[model samples]
Target: MGLAGALATPAHGDTKAPAVVNDARLEAAYVIMGDGFATVRIVTGAAGCPALTIDAKAQPMIVRAPHASLPLRPTASTIANSKPSVFPITVCEASLPPGAKRASVDGRPLPMPRPVIRRIVVIGDTGCRLKASENAYQACNDPEAYPFAIVAAHAAAWHPDLVIHVGDYLYRENPCAPGHAGCAGSPWGYGWDSWKADFFTPGAALLAAAPWTVTRGNHESCERAGQGWWRLLDPRAMQPRHDCNDAADDVTGNYSAPYRVSLGQGAQVVVMDLSHAGKKNIAADDPRYDEFVSTHDALARYARNATFTFATDHYPILGVTIPDGEPDKPPKAGNKAFQSTFGQVDKGLVPAGVDVLLAGHVHLWEHVDYSGNTPSQFIAGFSGTQEDAVPLPSRLPVDTSPLPGVTIRQFDAWTDGFGYMTMERTGARSWKVTVRHADGSLLRRCRIRGNHTYCEPIFG
Candidate 1:
């Protein structure tokens, strides 16, 4: 009998079932040589006798687990195939094996391996363009404008392990530039084939680089394409996937998968599809809208050290101000139709730990802060269009009720430019968000650090 078995044999009157923990919490096991980093080896099963050996002089040091368990099959430096693959797992310091030598429970070898690390990149509201002037705004989709190429360049330059596109991939009914033949095969406008040809083909360089997490915006509404949008991109459409809604008239009804991304250390990001009918193309008070909110509420409870959580959709809540007497009024309700989207964000996200909310669709740039001091929000979507620069208004509508330390930059100075933002981890618990122009010119930079707060703006 093995040591564990022998110990369980009992000496005399100890007749209680030998305690055996099958689902015991598992941590990391490390072995060090000299002063350098330790090399860890893990076995797959209980019999594997995974013995951990460490240098006598070297003591145990807590290291964060790098491996993150995923639902998909793991991808290990392998080329892309039709088959799916999983990312390397994440590991933490607590996961390490105890003691400086072989770890054996009564001589049973414990098996464990080093953790894996992954990189991630996030972008939103790319490719969708709406109502551009014939000649002036024509450059948006021009084959030469290299819309896809730009995305590709950014991907190549950063080489993120994964990509998160926050929606607005296609703008149905929005006429193509002057030259594009027509929306011929599109299901809504030209169909998936046309979109694949224009969007997928052009942006092939970047799309090919990483796995994608796609979200929906107002443009994906059925009113625009029936059920085409959901069919094309939803990972769980036909498969009875996770729905934040259940009852017929439930207020909480979400349509997308809830994914947690670990950015190493204790930091994690929980991404949710917050699209509700109330703010966009659908009717106000759409049950699905409530579902989106509830789903996020559930996620906010779990992600730890998640200093910041970002929500994305294709609508802007603050920033652009219509001329006092302008004839055209904003939408009455829903995401695309009006300014009411802010109410949804106010009621649903802030309390749930969302530090930043990203939106587009106004075709103009705007940033908002509900909590005057900490936690910032922004609307960055001037991509793929040609519009004249309009300065930000001096007087801005600031939501002071929440008082969550949020700030909105009322940029009266708006300029015609295609741009993207880069979020990088600069310190143990801080992220630097930099918004840049098409040519990589820095436009705005803010450092997000501690207790949902952002530092003063540093302009380019």
Candidate 2:
């Protein structure tokens, strides 16, 4: 069956809920508000429906909880580069019942809000690519090979309080050849159908489990899937950009804004966008460079307020694993950007109380501890996407290792199977981070105290 046909077919024993106009069901499940109060977003494919009205009252697309009737609000704007502009999404804020284990959306049950947030699951770069010419190891058609479905299921089973996806949600840009395993008759363009197959469907379970803080990766560029990125995942207000064509230097519509997620008291996660800043020496006059600097300074100020602060972005600041076919040279521009902003050990540009720097892009996993730096850097991009060959242990060595006072204390890299990181807050000042494979096999575990990290092998 084709992608849309397959989705239209209901799962076994799933009583078909009353269909809105054009059979719109909930797509891209997410919680907007994090605390005890929650605002849920449900995207529907019903064309021209902009908001959902519950009962006879015309609600502004926001639904309050405790069994409220919701009706389709038929108003939505067309996305740039999208066909027909048929996807209209709505957001509803509801007060989940106390001690409620599950909540209902349009009569469909879903996991409820957590009383407290202690565990957070981090995954990234999970889009599946079907082109055989790309030389990916997994067979795209086989669910077992392209196991993001399984990965998302495992993550949902853990019942995390929150999910932090460091970006790259859509990937099926190239069409699959005839008779390819999972690609035969599949939708191949950058549209709602492709997104449903690549992300929404496989990610449904996890998306319903808890709220998510999403980052914008390079794959989410306007030229590639920017329209979908803005419509589906971005938490910020939408601002349409007409210049979303496929151009290498085009950075329009790339949201460079920085936002923060409060993780209870004394902790917060700050998300920044460095998608537009390419791996070249960004001139001081460049707006992207200026934005990066201002964002970095804002992160520094946030660090001072929170006892434990985590900064996440799509690009890695240090020790990036070179992609398979890319050149072996160091990332001069990325390094320069970091040095000019956060890597200034002598000038104290790196902020205090920032415990961790989480990033993804290189498709490998690494944990780097600096001798004098406040935050330990972690690369957890090995969620489900094809991984690049693991670089040598000492690959991409820092040019000026002992930069004034900063020194590389220790570094570990892994380029094997797909995996994710789970952070469990054990105490007010203590937390445990575990790196596990897609199937829940423990790979490594570490303890974080103040700003120091000590990790040991799980079975060594």
Each prediction's whole-model lDDT (CA): 0.41, 0.62
Off by over 4 Å in 2: 1-24, 33-38, 47-103, 110-115, 130-138, 178-182, 240-252, 323-334, 340-349, 394-404
Per-residue accuracy of model 1 over 335-435 as CA lDDT, tens digit each = 33222333355443344555565565545454544434333555555554333334444454454222234344323323445666666766655677666
> Considering summed lDDT, which 10 consecutive residues are worst modelled in model 1?
28-37
lDDT of 2: 0.62
Candidate with maximal TM-score: 2
CA lDDT of 377 in candidate 2? 76
